[model samples]
Target: MNQSPLVIGARSIDVGYFNVKFTLGRPASHGGPAPVGNFPAIAPVLRSGAARHMEGVAQPDGCVVPINGVTYFVGPGAAQRGSGTDARLVKEDYATSDRYLALLRGALWRIAGDAGDAGDAKDVVIRRLGLGLPLNTYFDAAQALRDRAVGEHVVGAGANERRVTVEQARVIVQPQGTIIHFGYTNGGKPLEGVTMVVDPGGGTLDWYLSERTTPYWERSGAYPKAMLACAYAVADRLDPGWRDQPAIVDRIDRAIREQRSSFTVQGQEIQMAEHRPAVEQVLDESIDQMLTAVGKMDDVDHLLFTGGGASVFSARLQKRYPRLKKITRMDVDPIYSNVRGFQVVAEADLASAKGW
Candidate 1:
């Protein structure tokens, strides 16, 4: 009798427009939390000639990945050393773009490296891979996204290269991951009645309405006005030229997240207090649009918030719905909620497949 290949485990990668979150499921022996992390969703392409020179430099915050003959420096510091072009992908077709693949591969490379599996011939094989698509695109693009994800991928370059095989992939509406995560963390108790999840991300404000876990497709959708909208509005007021610079937008986002009244730009300190009204105005408009889409909330038993912008919109959401509950805790960072839920779902599916 032939022996079957050992199933290492499952992993999830939540690739958002502004950031990429991932989770490597916890080991059986460990009773603690799973290993989870995230990096900015910036993948700067490098020409073959330039990539060769990068081999000698040390990248503490990011890595260089080669996929399909193209090279990209992905993660935090990548934008600074990358070519002068904007590396952030905000287009609707981003799920199928080269930059998206590069970020996904780069994240796998990082996970393998951190787990001490880099350069191993045996490879790090994830039995199941969980991913998410924005509400607006989930219907039309989820299948394509899953197809791209479920396969063998070689990440990194030369000596740093590592093989990662995704045996299966599961794609869900981005915000749905939060509810799944919420239930998993709360002792597997099923959510009662109707639940609405409002996920404010960088590029979109995605909402999902469901009774328990079954979705109400008609009431859920995404709005393009989200964090970037505030960033752009603030940028336009600060300097119209800054609107095109993702780095500037990133800085503004950080400031907004930190609740800082000022930020630095090209060695000069810029006051952000003047831009508060603009940010509030845009956020208010986004909240109105979200409310309009979800219609009456009287039937909603639980109103939850998640995603990178969860905290940013928490106040407005709480004020609007006094019963609003944030899908976050002291240990759970809202940004990683989706990927964590992905891991939970993957592990459960794997268990069920084996009749465990």
Candidate 2:
């Protein structure tokens, strides 16, 4: 309920896992905020089934345990998933990262470096905090190809660098897209009516269209161009000499935060509206590319946008198809819409597996 800010409901979060946003549809009968776990319970739910999966227990639900008078739901997931393995790896890889984060925070506070660290730091945090495996597992796989040295180095001194860049991972279509569509459509039937989804996220721009039967998506149409590009575009237009500045990216972020599309160069206002025709142009082209990808799915009816990007680019969307009746932005951040959508799908999978 980020957008409409809906009250949360029926949530069974892992016992003692804090950081969870639990907003019930109605406040608890006492009408006071529910207390959250303030500290990690050393042995919460220590003997649950999930613990069996993790440290070997008899049940799937982790056993209940108590530490310091705090009841802990030490389940299979926490060790099998949370701090035990995952947190260990993060602590390993980013050994100095908190110090780095503090440094980064200080720099950002001082406006010393780019304020754009949110995206990069997010990426770093995501890679570090991912489940199942550490990031080195991913990066090492890519490095393996370099160690093998495919095709005798096609280019020059920069060739290996280019190769590595090319090998850098990308979002796979099926994994993410399949979940995205299933959010509303169940992934069995094509979304009916003129449908468009604009998913703008920390890393990329996702666009889609579908009308019927087969989910509407154009693999190539899903561009990696992100919202920060818009911010950068605005900056370049305002500062003619910005390319020469080390603080250019930071200043661009600063300008965007300030709400003036352009930056100050020697006290002259640069008309960003005139400068980055490309951001707007890309917006339009992206829509067209989407239509081309989905190819007139005649049954589709709406244009729905989700992602952090949507909040920023809503005006551009309003201009794209002024005629559509339901040109709506998801009531939540687009990035998380797909997440909640996936949660629904995952729950459904669990039910279906149980013969529901």
Candidate 3:
């Protein structure tokens, strides 16, 4: 068994489909590591055997990273990599793979590094960790993920060989994380009525209803392909050939994230801003799909939106579902809201456990 760190409490992490955001416990002690990116797949920077954290354009000293023999750019500066037919989006099943775990370690590395910047002399240790799993993930799968995340040691050989340890951990369903977030932020606002949470993330669109009094979630649904539809639609408008090239598709997706007006396609410029209509059209379709799956959530008093991708289309969402009496707006970055909620939940759990 791995030894626990010399920390007083648990730290929380939210591993989203698009990003990994985490918060340190008693940040005043560990130094604050603001939410870090889950930038995928490390690439070896040329000539040094050192891997770059995220995508960027090739510098005079840079080269591309390969995954399964496919070369692509990751993280920042990705736009400079130019377009390729083999570029790929790096996503994995959090419940079944190490991708999310690696990202979690990445978050820890940032925390420790930040602590160093803050003049702290000890490495960061999380006595407990709260992890978020996608809604509708099976119980067994979530348990497996929780088991893997807790007490699991990860050494980021490419990421400065940074390490993080969790003495205890618990998994919160992703949608429920949003609910806890809304409830905690609302403060005494009765969560008694029906409330719906729609988390449109990079990989999945998760929706669930909670009847605030019962401590249970209802009618939870996961729409796996909804978030990608907009990117696909925008790509279709830009280049019919993009679908055939994972790299080009990824670039288009990145362009969407950067809110860029254009992206390169085999040395040609494809205007993205002009494709807003396509994006809106696809977004409408996605909403329609969600509405169909969610059916009519009658008497939904609270409609909270929290996810990395939620803010951009939240206005549209609010307009589309105007019947919701109170639309909760997140005061913090929507991407970190779920994790913040997870932290809140973990603290509550610890409090109950410790009789504090």
Best by lDDT: 1
lDDT of 1 by residue, 1-356 (tens): 02332346678898888888888668676444568878878787777523444677876466677767777887667777565446354578888888898889878776665654343333677788888889888888899988988888877666666777788988988888888888777777658898888888998988888998899989899988789888888888868777667788889988887788899998999888888889888888888888888888778877677777777887766666566554322225577888888887888878888898
Pairs of colliding residues, candidate 1: none
lDDT of each: 0.77, 0.35, 0.59
Q: For all candidates, what are the clash counts?
A: 0, 33, 11
TM-score, structure 1 vs. true: 0.89
Off by over 4 Å in 3: 1-5, 26-94, 115-124, 138-140, 152-154, 157-159, 188-192, 213-218, 240-274, 318-332
* TM-score for all models, in order of appearance: 0.89, 0.40, 0.72
Query: In terms of lDDT, which candidate is stronger, 1 or 3?
Result: 1
User: If ranked by TM-score, best first, what sequence of candidates would result?
Assistant: 1, 3, 2
What TM-score does candidate 3 reach? 0.72
* Model 2: lDDT to the true structure: 0.35
Question: Worst lDDT window (10 residues) for model 2?
Answer: 123-132
Q: By lDDT, rank the candidates, best first.
A: 1, 3, 2
